[model samples]
Structures are given as structure tokens and as C-alpha cells.
Target: MFGYVIKRHQLWSGKVLLFPLSSSCASGASGVRFVFGRASAAGTERRTAPAESTGQGEAMYRRKMRGMYISKRALRKHFDPHNYPRETYLLCELQWRGSHKFWQHWLRNDDSKDCHAEKYFLEEIFEPRSYNICDMTWYLSWSPCGECCDIIQDFLEEQPNVNINIRVARLYYTDRASNRKGLRELASSPGVTLEIMDAEDYNYCWETFIQPGVYYRFSPENFESAIKRNCSQLDDILQGLHL
Candidate 1:
């Protein structure tokens, strides 16, 4: 869930950014290093004399830059494992929205079907046979827990990977409001640190913690952006992350 578009500089320097994938370690030092594989042809320089250069042999220096230097947000599409095996994940809020019938139809479809995208994504992104997927309706506070927590806890208990991710489906307008309640619950939990974002005070957040490199899945216009904008100071724990 913490996946992000890393800053352009780190992308250029070929440094693997680290992020806290597990709740237990989320509050501690950089959780783990998810290294970005380096670009080829590092430091290979070439120089050409200026066309206007006098008898003096003045050369302009240039280095061959290997690897596509796309923007941070675009990295996921450019380097997706399905598309590019040696790929890393980017930030996204995956919501599960359809009914059982929808999933039933999905389960019956082949890879070529449009509905198959969700199933394929789950298979590739989620730990195999580890978590139970479910859908729950939204409410004022902790509404998802009574019905959904079991499936979630079951998945967490089964998956041993420290680098775990939570995915949701079927995002709606009300979903944003639900997010606030859910995040509050998570933050109030024993070890969770809730980073609430208020839309009106967004600029304060951006200047506070979000480091230069990290970018959230929420668009610039989304309420979450305001929160990130104000909490930019949290960048102290975010820059140059690997996991």
C-alpha cells in the first residue's frame, strides 16, 4: 500500500528506495531495501569538439545514459513484471468492489477476458494461497471489521512475506470518507501510525514530510494529496527506500 513514484534524481542515481511493508516495522528505521536495478553503461563518457572550436581542441563531455529514464509515476507501467520481469511495484489503491456474482463470472473467464485483469493481477501481486479475498460495504466507523477482518487477518496470518501489500477494489466517492475511518482505526491500533490528510490544509502537509522522490497513488486533486503535502516532513523516514 505504500508504493510510490520515486523522485527523478534517485531514479537517475540507480538507488533502491526502502519502505516499511509490514505494520510491525512501519514505525522503525527504513523497513527494507527494494533495490532498483542499476542502468547499464554507467560512467561511459564521450566528448566531441565544438564545431566553432578554434585550433584549440576544446571538447564537450557527454556520457551515454542507458535505461529508460521515465517519470517516477510511469515506472510501474514501463517496468511491470508481466511486461518486464525484473520490475518493481508502484503505488496504487486497489479496491475490491464487485459482488459475488461478478467474481464468479470472473473466476470462470479465461485470460483473454476483460474481467480477467483483476484475477491475473491478484495472482501475480498477492501471495499464492495465502490470503482470503472478500468485499465489505462502508459505514461510519469500523464497519468493515465485523465482516471483513476475518478474511484480512486470515491472509496476514498465512502469508509469511514481510513485504505484504493490501489491495482494495471498486473505489467510489464515499470510499474516501471510509478511508478516514479505516485509517483512524489502523492508527489507533497498537503499532499503527495514522497519517490523516485534510484537503483544505494540503499545502502545509506537502511542505512538511513527503520527500522529493516519493509520490502517492492519489492524484494531485485528491484529498490525500493535501495530506501528503502537509506531512512532507515524514520524508525523513521515506527517502532512498529499497523495500
Candidate 2:
């Protein structure tokens, strides 16, 4: 039979001492020969080497802990792992239309069609922390103006820290229906705190020329000035209402 035992005073290599017990213990024997294996000091040193190395490793680990900044909460959380991952972002693309629809699509998935539309068309109103608020629409008349205020409120909530910028065509004129919708949207959205600027209008005869009747030419400078004037009037109304 073979058995192993370790003493507290023994070093690392001293843990595996084997003792062999012969089956002749029951016999009434007067003398017994016991062979004792002598271990050299070098062998003893080698046996204890691993323990010494481990102790050194532990010392280094403790030293490293001095530079570590481990919050108690963090330590507890790490030791007891959580199943949930931290949320990192928000996605916004609601209430958009026309070519702006393409930007909505891009926000959802970048490989969408019409990705290269003009920068003036796609304005990104972001928070101070670089979070997206929402896409602003130039063709405001499509939606009723009454709903504009709520939409603007929602936008502000999404990006509370950043300012807003309204993008409009420099010389763009809308039909009666589009204009009505635009006015409604702007009127509804009152809490919209941001800068509004008209985009430099591109003169295309086919679109702007047919305004008066069969053809109507547009003046970019005049359109830009007109929008600014309207916005100023709206601002006054907002102040009057104490909004």
C-alpha cells in the first residue's frame, strides 16, 4: 500500500512524499528493516523552488494592486458578472420626407440609395455631446403645422444639450399645399431652440420657373431674405406667448 502526506513546514516540492507499507505488519517479528531514502540539500532546494517563485509572483501582484483603482462596486460587479450590457446610443429618424427620406434610410442603414445627396439637404441637429436630435424637414408643408411643436419638443428631449439649426432652401418656393404644411409644422414646434439658415438656392428653371404659371423664375437672394423675415415674426409670436 502507498500513501502520501504533507507537513505544514514542508516547502512546495515536499508535498509529494510517498510512504510504502508492506503487508507483513501482522506477523510477530522481533526485528524489522526500514530503508530511509536520504534527500540531498540540492534536491530539497529544487523541491522548494516552485513555492519560492509563486511567492515572488504573489508579491508582484500585490505591488501592482497599489497602482490599480478598483472601485468597491466595480469589484463586486465584476466578481458577480451581470447578464446585461450597457446601452451606448440612440437612433432618431422620425418625421422626414422627400429627399430627406433618403437620410432617414441612411440613418437606419448606410448602404441605402441616394446616399450622396447634397449636404444642404441633410442637416444633422446634434446635442452638445454629439447625439443626434432628429432630421429637420425643408418641405414642411407636407405635415400639418400643428404637429411641429410636439416634434420639436421630442427633438429637444433627444438632444437637450445642443442647439438646433434649421435648414431651408435659399430660393425655394413651395406650392399652396406644401406651404400650408410647412407653416403648420413650424407653428407646432415652438420649443425648437436653434439657428435657422437658408441654403444657397440652386437655380433650376424646370422647378422654380413654373411658379407664376407655366414658368416662374426665382431670385435666391429674395427667397432667403423672405424666410428670415418670417422666422423673425414667428420669434416675436413665441415671445408674446411667453414660450
Candidate 3:
């Protein structure tokens, strides 16, 4: 996950300064577009301002600024959809020895890219660590499937130093007996913690990591209700299987 903060310039011209908060993006950059209005005012219009320099300096600066703006906007637009309805993507945040790392991976149902998020985490992040203890928290748009459960179960059995905490948008279960058994197995894991994500968790991730500028207005009570509803349905399915 990536985010940027905006800095406003104190100008008497009533124009608000907006710049990409990233260091790499801000390097060698000049003036950006300014909005002429009060901070509390609505529908403020933005107007382009001339670069502070000309010739090679202006051209190179604009090129870098444009690339950063386009890339940041494109990433937000492309990944925002994956966090809902589709539930095909997963993001992991790892905290170890006062350092934090993030990894985002997606799973496709039929394609060769059917790699699981856990496998990616193990191969990319966990393998490189020299420390023995690490805490891994997963922000999954959908719960793990049966195959994923088996893979993670084997992993935890081998690596006792890792602790996993999973917060998911929704559960994915079926009427199949194997699926139900898998869910039970995953829930019974000793070193792993799993739960439906609450609004606080959602808001924290949204503000601190995903999109710093946008506020997530979802309520914790509503999220709890959704979890209850999903649990009720899962209970009915499990009762039908008599397991």
C-alpha cells in the first residue's frame, strides 16, 4: 500500500498549492497547479501556473512531475476496485524488529498466476529476514480457500517463529464438505488469529496506508452485523454437513 500527503502553500493570491508528497516525486520539481479559494470553501476551481524556470529545467521538471502524478493516480484507480466485490487481491503488512514492510499480491482462479498470498510472503519477505520473530497481518478482500488453508497450515507447522493475524472483508465458503473441513482446520490453528475486519481496522488501513487523504466512513457496528450474518449462514451450512 502507498499514500501521499498534500502540502498547502500560504499565498495571498488565494491559490492553494498542491504537490505530490513523495520525496522521489518532489525532487527537481517546480510549482504545481494552484486552487484559488478558502480551505473550507466548496467547488474551488484550480488554475495552472507557470513553472518557476524555463528551458531544460522546466521540461525535465514537468516530465518527472507528470510521471509521478499519472503513476500515483493510476495505482489508486486500478487497485481500489480489487478491494471490493471482486475480492481477487490480497495485501500483507509485516512488522519485525521495528521495521515495517508491505507486499501486495493477486490470485487468479484459472490462470497460471493462481499463486497464493502466503506463498508470496514466505518467498519474498520471510526468507530474507535474519530475525527469528515477526508478526504478519493480512488484509484480505476474501477469506482463504481450502487449498490455501492447507498451504498455510503446513507453513505454520514448519515455522514456529511467525505469528499471523488475518482480517478479511468476507468469508468464502461453500456447501462442499471439504471446504467446511478446511475452514475448521484453519480456525483451529494455534498460532494464527482470524476475524472479520472491523471498521476501526478498515479506517486505520485507509488513512495510514492505502489513501491518507480519503476518510473511510464505514461504521464498526455495521461491519459487525455483516459478520454476524455471514456467520449465521456458515453455521447453517455446517449443521447440514453434521460436522
lDDT of 2 by residue, 6-77 (tens): 111112232423332233211111111111232111000101111111121100001111211222332122
Candidate 1: how large is its RMSD? 21.4
Task: State the TM-score for model 2.
Answer: 0.25
Model 3 residue 132 lDDT score: 40
User: lDDT of each prediction vs. the true structure?
Assistant: 0.24, 0.25, 0.45
Instruction: Candidate 2: count the clashes.
Output: 12
Off by over 4 Å in 2: 1-144, 158-163, 168-218, 241-243
lDDT of 3 by residue, 28-47 (tens): 21112221222111111121
State the number of backbone clashes in model 1.
30
Please identify which of the two predictions, 1 or 2, would achieve the higher TM-score against the true structure. 2
TM-score of each: 0.23, 0.25, 0.54
User: What ordering of candidates by lDDT runs from best to worst?
Assistant: 3, 2, 1
- Write down the worst ten-residue block by lDDT for model 3: 53-62
By TM-score, the better pick of 2 and 3 is: 3
Measured with C-alpha atoms, the lDDT of residue 133 in candidate 2 is 23
Candidate 1 — which residues are off by over 4 angstroms? 1-123, 128-154, 160-176, 188-243
RMSD of each: 21.4, 34.4, 15.9
Residue ranges of candidate 3 with Cα displaced over 4 Å: 1-84, 97-112, 128-131, 214-224, 231-242
Q: After superposition, how far is residue 187 of candidate 1 from its true place, in Å?
A: 4.0
